[model samples]
Target: MLRLTVHRHFSTSSAFFANRAIVYHSNGNPRSVLSALTFPSLRSPPPNSLNIKYLLAPVNPADINVIEGVYPSKPSPTKLNSDNVFVAGNEGLAEVTGVGSGVSGFENGQWVVTGKQQCGTWRSGANVNVEDVIKVPKGASEVGAATITVNPATAYNMLSEFVDLKEGDWVIQNGANSAVGQAVIQIAASRGLKTINFIRNRENVDALKKQLEELGATHVTTYEELSQKSFRDKVKEWTGGKPLRLALNCVSGPETMSMARLLGSDAHLVSYGAMSKQPLSLPTSLFIFKNLKSVGYWQSRWYTERTKEEREKLMEVLVGLMREGKLKEPEHEIVTLGAGESDEEASNKVRDVMKNIMEGQYGKKVLLRLEGE
Candidate 1:
């Protein structure tokens, strides 16, 4: 049975219900600042709200950057036991368990993901405003819905927003093995667009290349290949001298500049992240003579700028792709918090995972399942 309560007070119930949130009082190192607390559980949804139980949440790099106070957007502090604190997740898949009196169109057992940005989804359960979440179709898989809003959306938008790519047209991008990068490969393949994917050379690079190619990548190479002038001729040969119209960059540095160099006149270079933590420098001749247009894309801003209906439409398209198997779930691992665990044990477990993620030990996406009892 689940123990039930609200805020700091406990409410009598025949069943036992509880809520545990991974929160940080101050922004700093994730391992040092992140801790677990047992917040009150919802007995019923507040007016115009829906009580939601989180099913799965992912520990994205942006979540860690938010805790480090480096990301552009910040999560609004959540009210818990009369005090406000920041929860540590940005994306999650949840199930509605209770609906407030004034709320309609939602009921128990509906699956959803937050429509709002930086929703602080790292909790077992909470009462969320109706407008904050978008419904996930029943056909969508748990992983697809849980991880949809950020990476896949970013990939879909970046591909269409910057350049008007057509079938057989070539696109170039760095970080070809990143989550968004992989999605780019698949989505482009679905649309008949070709991608020249680039990544850092690694010990298992051959296997990694094979994996990406299996997902529909036209070509997979490393930055080492991009550094060679000879490789530019090879890329030219692959595209039959057709200008690469779009360049997607997440890792910024000399490699990004090299990737941009492959673009032809009037091409657009869209950047979404700076994993290299270095400045993006390019030659003036490229921008002046080549007419290269440089731009940045943030998926959060895209949501804030659009209407609820528009957001749903995008989700509808993506979910349809998911149902059709055009877009596959990201390669990931789940980090679970058992219901029987103590707050200390849960906090330690999360911290250990964050530590590994920070150190680049874990290559695939990491999801979280925090069970509160």
Candidate 2:
């Protein structure tokens, strides 16, 4: 039998229990298991942890990549598992249904979500340290809060960390229609900056333009259009010689080089992912004369390593934006994978959601359909 030590709250005579999870028994693949195998509960909830009853969790591509054993992050062992296997998910919104003695800033009925790393969040309940979670505003949408991690935070930090773009300065990004891209667009717009967004061609190009425009995009163009000399000329005419200060590159390889080329001198190019599975290429001139900078980002690393006070400040900024309706979670197609849900059905849901996100089928975030909401 599997032997594990958890806080003293959970004990089971049987060797197994159930919690919904996504598992990749081997590399390069993954599937969700509903009512999946479980083990002993917490012997006692950690002294400072608040037992979270999950409200919602996002199904991010990075989460999928982790399941495929492609992402660099590795989950830690927790009492939630029966055989001590892994459960996969990035960040999610929860409620403080139970709190450990001495934990402050949390109480029953308060809404909250993860603000740090190392605590697994896919299942129904979680024992998270008070410092690792942030109290979400009562009026915030659980769906939107579920997306507070990774994309939203990444967009906020990258734009804030890189060169300070003024109202007239522009930011360019690819996977522009991606969730992070959308977040960047909104945040920049709310901050009075302009945006030059690029996206791959999809089935409904016309519809997509209206959507981005509504989100305050200054301009939206396809990859092919961006490669044209005339397009760059047209861009110069529209921007009135003000160069793009930052290029957020998620799908690297040649696109990374192209984004760098589009920036003004002393511009910063931040690379967060390599969706194209291609090497990042750059021209020598950018490094030598233009003084261009390329930075890599992984939100998991950022959240875990940053100080607790820093986390609170970041969360407060984002929540304030949401309160003003300046920030938002993507519109979503929700897929439930919880109690009484079948594994086969849940597997199909995950596959469909992944396809839609990667292929740009849905113009919104794909959330794991949850029970509480």
Give lDDT tens digits, candidate 2, residues 245-284.
7889989878667767888888888988777889889999
Cα error, residue 245 of model 2, in Å, equals 1.7
Worst 10 residues of 1 by lDDT: 1-10
- Among these predictions, the greatest TM-score belongs to 1
lDDT of 1 by residue, 1-373 (tens): 1111333222223134388888877788998878777776687787999999999999998899898887778787777767567888989999999999888888899998988888889999988999999888766889889999999999999998888888999888899888999999999999999999999999999999999999999999999999998998999889999999999999999999998889899999999988898988888899999999999999999988988888888888889888889899987898988777777788889999989999999978899998864
TM-score of 2: 0.85
TM-score list, all predictions: 0.93, 0.85
Cα displacement (Å) at residue 74, model 2: 0.5
